[model samples]
Target chain A: MRKVAVIGAGMTLFRRRLLETGKEMCFQAVQMALEEAGLELKDVDAVVSGSAPDAFDGVHMKGEYLLDGAGGVRKPYMRVFTGGGTACFSPIAGWWHVASGLADVVLVVNEEKMSSITPHPQYAFANIWDPILDRPLKPNLVWIFAMEMNRYMTVYGIEKADIARVAVKNKRNAVDHPAAQLADPNITVDDVLNSEVMAWPVQRLDISPPSDGASALVLASEDVARQVSETPVWISGVGWCIDSTMWTNRDLSFPEYLARAAQQAYGMAKIENPRKEVDVVEPYDPFDYKELHHLEGLLLADKGEAPILTREGVTQRDGELPTCPSGGLMGVGNPIAATMGIKTGEIYWQLAGKAGRRQVPGSPQVGVCQAWGDLMQFSSVMVMRA
Target chain B: MVGEEYRRWEGDMEALYVYTAGVAGDRFFREIRDNERLMGTYCPECDVTYLPPRLYCETCFSELNEWEEIPNKGRVDAITVAYVDDKGERLARPKVLAMVRFLGANGGLIHVVDLPEEDVYRGMEVEVVYLPRGLRKGSFLDILHFKAI
Candidate 1:
């Protein structure tokens, strides 16, 4: 594979409610990313867009609906979705564009207008269940997550207090993120524990707020990258994996999907030990417990040991591992595909020494971004080095 | 750019989605309709058992042939009292959605909870509540919601 680099990144404010249409959000972010890359719409050779379910947007063939706004009007464009992993997968798609000599400049965009749906975005997920069997049970989306949290807590011997720490840390980190929607809150373990329970093991505070937003990143081949920017972040490796959709058949306490994906990325990146080799980590965290769950999956910590590292402050911003320095989807807000771009964008800034407040003390040399989704069936991982 | 008048679209669209019957979905609903407990199909080849049920073993590439019954009782994994519908419009009040995993099951299934919105939590015990025999529609809504056992 040829070398690929991120030339520029742009994103809209993550908000609970945005009057702008989904297309508008995409156009705005794409325009900004292109401008930052010192290019124009005409310079993009291919476009890749990703969003979760079209049910949330209430628009079918959403990729075709979003083509023009994503700058794919008459160019090569394709849409990819692996549930919530859509965002990270967008850039990985871009990576292959340059790697395969298909297109030199790829425009990657992701948008999720969860706010456009009514009643609850959770309701749209009702259809994601087995329509014949599980659907008849009248299961809501929260039930599966609740079951996973229960198993994680039981298997890891983690308490509600330990899970609360993630919410507190990520929210605190969001205070400095300009686009974060849930960035400010003086929350504690008691705060999370006392919040209303949406399910047995999940409280209101444990979940990230539904959001509407868009993000864009521009990727260029080695020659174009050098011409585009002085501080382009190099993409060393990209990998993605999918577990069986039969989620009930496997262990839910940890994400084996993420482990396989990470292994693929590490092999391509030629890293022996992820925990020791990678300088910064960003594991997808839509729920507080998920950060810990994915930490083990990413091999940042051994299975059943992530919670211990988290409790010891080893995964904190100033700690040994430094996970979710961008506040994650938990703190930064989750708008489906856009959440992963924030992780991608944050690594770009961190590797460039541009993260002002949430910056790791040391000048980070390597970083990893991971996203898990699709009823815990899909995982996407990318490794970047400065 | 075209004027607003020219930009308006006047047309119709039709789309369809096709899916295969996965591992446990068929038996899960069938057992529930028959008032029998249901779980997932476990493949000895991959050593993985599925919950919401499936048709094949993902790891071992074997056809799943067994439907294991698991206890209905399990701890809550996550919960939410969503105030808005799927369209993002605010409802008069919120409805509770919970992710619950059964004992010895690999994954949890989502369902509505009969418990008051305030009584839910991460580890609360809940049991499946089947719909009335006469009211069964063979759809996902057959079970109104799970309740605290």
Candidate 2:
């Protein structure tokens, strides 16, 4: 397989509402990516678009509708969906395009217009579960996360304050991030603990607000990458997996499916010990407990140990093994499918020494980004190196 | 200077589906209606009995026909006290919800339980209080609340 590298990355300001339509958002992100890569729209060979659930945007067959804005005019374009994992897996789809001699330069774009959904943005999430079994319960999305957090907490004897500290760190770290929507440097653990309890374990502050945003990356073959970028971040490994849709069947304390996905990526990267080898890490953090949950799933920390590392300030922007230095989905807006802004785009900035104030401590060499999706079933991981 | 108005289109489609109960669900619901006992599909390959049974085993995807009459009582895996409903309206009395796993069952049912907030804790056993046989509708709510045993 030929080597693939990320030549450029771009994102829109994640906001609760954007006047721009989904197509326009895609155009904005793709334009920035093309500009950064020094390539015109005509230079792109193929387009890989990622978005989740047409229900949110109220557009069925959304890919075809978004084609023109993605610069896929008269080009081979395909859409990918793996729930929230679409952000990270979209680039993986681009990697295969360049790696298999399919396309020289692939434009990977993701956009989520969550604000378009009427009522509360959280209402769209109600469809994520089984209508027959789960919908009968009249569940709001917060109940599921709260239940999972409660189970994980009970199993590990994890304190609520320890979990709240993750919210404190990521939202504070978001203060330096340009595209962050919920950045607040003054937020404390008490503030999180005392925040409105949407669900007992998951309070309003523990979760990321729904947002409208888009993110894009330019993936090119080895030759095209060298020409486009002086410091191309090489795609070392890509892995994705999905567990059972029957969420209640498995133990919710640990994300076993995510661990499997990471193992595949880590294996391909020849990374035997992620804790020692990976310098910067970005795990999907739609919720504060999720970052800690995924940290273990990625093998960066032992089971039930992510909270302890978090409490010790090891997960801060300038700490050892900085996780979600771009403020994560918690700090940045969580536009569901557009979270690649942190998972992939943030890693690119950190590796290229262009993350501005949110950059990691030292000369970082390797980073891993992952996302979870689809009713706690899907997981996607990418290992990148500078 | 005059401000130009932009159009914002908003319409909601009401989609309704006639979902088939399938082989397993059909049997599971029929038992609830005919007999007041809860049923489960036991996968012999895995030796695990699944509550809210499925036609195929989730682990091996093996076609499962073996059914068992699981006890109607189980311990709470988790409990939530909801202050509001789906419409974001506050309820007069907060609903107490629990995910109750029947004995030796791999999965459980999420239902509103009749238990006080202070008395509720993980692992507390609760029994399903089935609606009167006359009121049985073959739906999940046939069993009204899982009262404290």
Candidate 3:
């Protein structure tokens, strides 16, 4: 396959309620990315739009509704949704558009308007469960995730404080993010521990707020990229995997789906030791413990040892393996599919040396970003290089 | 076990949504409700006027910063007579629905046309009959219907 490179990236402010519609947000993000790449809509050959669910935006056939704003008018446009995994999966779809030589330039847009859902966006998750087996239980995401967190803690003998440290580090790192919604520089572990408990062991502070936002990335063939950008970050590898829907039957402590996804990406990227070779990482962290859990799943740390890395400050922005330097979903806010801004977007910025204040200490060449979604069943991984 | 009868369970998806009109829609609807005027966004590059006032041009994908006041008069591009309500119940009077396209605009608005079935024809000019100012809300409902001009 031919090589693809990310030439531009854009993101809107992560907020609880944005006055702009999903189409408007997509337009703003696509405009920024086009401006950054010094390209026009006519230059785009195809478009890949991503959003978590139709319920969140309150619009059916959301991809078609959002296509015009994403500059997909009269173009090859397709929508991909894999729960929250669409953040990175959409970019992967853009990669194939370029790699397969069907398109020279592709724009990938991910948008979410979670605020449109009344009461709370979490209410949308109720429909995601199986009608016969899962829906009857009236289980919400926080309740299910609480059980997952409790399992991980019980299996590893981990402290809540250790998991809270990820929140502290990411929120602190978000202080430098211009579009972050929850940046708290002086936040402490005690603040998280003392926060209101939504579910046992899962406090309100540990969760990222549902947000309204859109993110865009411009992917181009190597030739077009080299012609347009002097510092194009090549998408060296991409991988995604999803496990069965029966989440109750599996081990919640470790994400086997993420591990398999990471292996596929690593195998293509040809990096044997992720801990040493990967310069920066952006693991999905809608919940604080998911960050550590993803780290182990990515094989960046040994099983149950991810919390140790956090305790020693290994995942800090300036640490040995800086993770979520864009403050991740925890600090920057979680807009579901729109989190492509911090996941793959942050990785591209870091590898291109354009992360500004949120930049890691050393010059990083390779970065790996992962997004988890579905009923703890989906993971999408992308490996990028400067 | 293979010959056992299957039982089915019933459930309802209790999902509710509150959609905002967004930036352009807010401005467009506000103009209609407050000033009784229709607004359209113009793209100089594409030389296209977008009805419903989109923030950007769909063709050229350029930001449409230019706003123009469109006359609340248009010609019916398409018409359909609906005999049933949304729930498929029969209605006493058929609703005249038409896609009204404004002159010099790239898109049109689809709404009910308050005209007799015999009078409603494609290309027939129609003018918007808005609700009274006191009853106007910043929404499409503010325009009661289009009447034959």
Best by DockQ: 3
Task: For residues A1-386, write the lDDT of model 2, one tens digit per residue.
Answer: 99999988889899988766677677778878878888877678899999998878877898987776677768899999999999799999989999999999999999888877777765677777677677777778788889999999999999999999988888989999888899998999999999998989889899999988899999999998887689899999899989888988988999999999999999999999889999999999999999999999999999999999999989887789899998999998799889997899889889988888988978799999999898878899999999
Number of the top lDDT candidate: 3
> For model 2, what is the alpha-carbon lDDT of residue B87?
98
Model 3 over residues B19-67: C-alpha lDDT tens digits? 8999899999999999999999999997889898999888888888899
DockQ of each: 0.01, 0.01, 0.79
Interface RMSD of each: 19.6, 18.8, 0.9
* Candidate 3, residue A75: how far the Cα is off, in Å: 0.5
User: How high is the CA lDDT of each candidate model?
Assistant: 0.82, 0.86, 0.93
Looking at model 1 chain A, which ten-residue stretch has the lowest summed lDDT?
A19-28
Residue range with the least summed lDDT across 10 consecutive positions in model 2 chain B:
B11-20
Better-scoring candidate (lDDT), 1 or 3: 3
Off by over 4 Å in 2: B1-149
Clashes of each: 54, 0, 0
Candidate 3 is scored at a TM of 0.98
lDDT of 3 by residue, A1-386 (tens): 99999999999999999999999999999999999899999999999999998988888899999999888989999999998899899999999999999999999999999999988876788888888888777777788899999999999999999999999998999999999999998999999999998999999999999999999999999999999998899998899999988888998989988999999999999998888999999999999999999999999999999999999988888789998999999999999999999999999999999999998978899999899898889999999999
TM-score of chain B of 2: 0.92
Please, what's the RMSD in Å of model 1? 23.3
User: Model 2, A380: alpha-carbon shift in Å?
Assistant: 0.3
